[model samples]
Target: MTRDGPDNPARPLAGTDLCALADLADPGSKGFRFRQERLMFAGFVVRVGDEVRGYVDSCPHAGWPLAAWDDRYLTREGDLILCGGHAALFRPLDGVCVAGPCADQRLSPWPVAVIDGRVVTT
Candidate 1:
C-alpha cells in the first residue's frame, strides 16, 4: 500500500464517484490524484470495453509514477498498461507485470467499480 500519511487519500471511501463511464474512453485510462496538505495519492483506472480496473500509479520497481502524462497509461493498441517510467508492461485486468524490471510483481489494486454508468470507489 502507498500510504502517504494519516490521511489515507489513496483509498477513497466506498461509493465515491470518480467519473462517468461515458466520459472514460473504452480501452482507455484515466489518472487520479488525491491530496491532503503535503501528502498526495496517485492512482489510475483502466477501462477495457465494459470492464474497469484501478491500480495504484506507483511502479513496483522504483516506486515512481507509471505514466508520464495524464490519461496515458495504456499502450498504443490499448491492450496493456505501459509504465512510462521504465517501459514496463502490465495486464490491465490484473495489474500483473508481465515484462520489465518488476516481472512477476503486480501493481497494487485500488478497488473500483462501474455503477449505474459511473465509475466509483468500491
Candidate 2:
C-alpha cells in the first residue's frame, strides 16, 4: 500500500532512526521496510557524498517497487537512480524519471534527514 498517507500503518513516523550515515557508502543506496500488521512500507535512501535523498519504493509507471534486489537502486556507474523493474532511470537529487516507460514521471519523495550522523525520518 502507498505509505504517503498519515493513516497508512506502514508509514514511518518522524524522528524514526534508519541507519548511521557511516554505514552507508559514499555513493550508495539502501532500502528500508516498515510493517504494521498486514501493511508494509518500502522506501530507499541514496547517498551521494554528503547529500542523501529518499524516495518511495514504488515506480510510477508499473506501480511496483523499483529495486529488484536489496539496495540496488542506482545504475552500475552510480550516476542515476535505476528502476530495476522497467529499467527506468531517475535523477537522484530529485525523483524525476529521465528514461524508460516512466520518463518524465517522478518517484514520490520521502522526507528524511541526517541528524548526528544518523539517517532519520523527518
Candidate 3:
C-alpha cells in the first residue's frame, strides 16, 4: 500500500515457502509471516489452486497488516481480505478493492507467480 506498484523492483520477497502452502487448502485461507526481512520486505506466501502466490502483509485500508488474528483472514467465502479495523474486502487475485469502506482501494499486490512448485515474489 505504499507509493509503489506491485512490480516496483524492490524484491518484495526473498526466500519462498512451499511447506506453508498447506495452510491455504481452503479458499480465502492464508498463513504466512516473515521470519526474516532482509531488504525491508515481509514475505507472505499463499496457496491458490496448485500454485502458491506471495504478497506483502500490509493491508491497503489504513496501512495496517492483514489477518485479523492468528492466521485467519476472514471466512472462506468472504472472497476478500477483510480489514480488522474498518472491514474492507480486498480481492485476492489482483488485490483489487472489491467491497466495504475501501472499495476503490486495492491491497497493493506484490508481483508474484508460481514457477515449478516455487512461489517467487519479485
Candidate 4:
C-alpha cells in the first residue's frame, strides 16, 4: 500500500516476493511501484551484507534515481551508493549524502524489512 506523502511515510509491504534477499547483490538494485487509493508509490531496494534497505530512489542533487541507467546503483566495492548522473555518493546506513556534489544532502528513505527470505516494505 502507498502512503500519501512527499514525506514518504512508512507503509506496509504489499503482496509477496518483490524480490529475494539474495537477489539484491552488490552493483544490483531493484525497483518497485505500488498503487494505493489514487496515489502511485515507488521505491528502490539495495542489498547490504545480511540486510537490505529501501529508498525513494531519488538523489538530492537533481532529484533523480542514483543508478547510472539501470540496476547498477552502487560502486564496484558496493559500500557507497553512487549517483553516476552527478557523481554523488551516499552512505548505505541511512541513505545519507556523503560525498561529491550533494555532500551534506540526503536521499529520502523508505522503510524495509526481510521476511521469509524475501525483501519487503515495512
For candidate 4, the TM-score is: 0.77
lDDT of 3 by residue, 25-75 (tens): 645355444332333343354554664445566776566667777556654
Q: lDDT for every model?
A: 0.87, 0.90, 0.55, 0.73
Ranking by TM-score: 2, 1, 4, 3
Tell me the tens digit of each residue's lDDT in model 2 across 37-113. Answer: 77888889999999999898899998899898999899998989998887999999899999999889899999999
Q: Judge candidate 3 against the unseen true structure and give its global Cα lDDT, from 0 to 1.
A: 0.55
Residue 18 lDDT (model 2):
95
Instruction: Give all TM-scores, in the order shown.
Output: 0.92, 0.95, 0.65, 0.77
- In model 2, which regions exceed 4 Å deviation? 1-4
Candidate 3's C-alpha runs over 4 A off are 1-15, 18-23, 35-40
- Best by lDDT, which number? 2
Ordering by lDDT = 2, 1, 4, 3
Greater lDDT among 3 and 4 belongs to 4
Displacement of residue 57 (Cα, Å) in model 1 is: 0.7
Tens-digit per-residue lDDT, 1-122, candidate 1: 35733257555678889999998888999999886655677878999989999998889898989998888999999999999988999999999999999999999898899999999988
lDDT of 4 by residue, 1-122 (tens): 44435543343355445788777775467877666556566678887777688888677788765676667777888888898788888988688888888899877887778898988766
TM-score of 2: 0.95
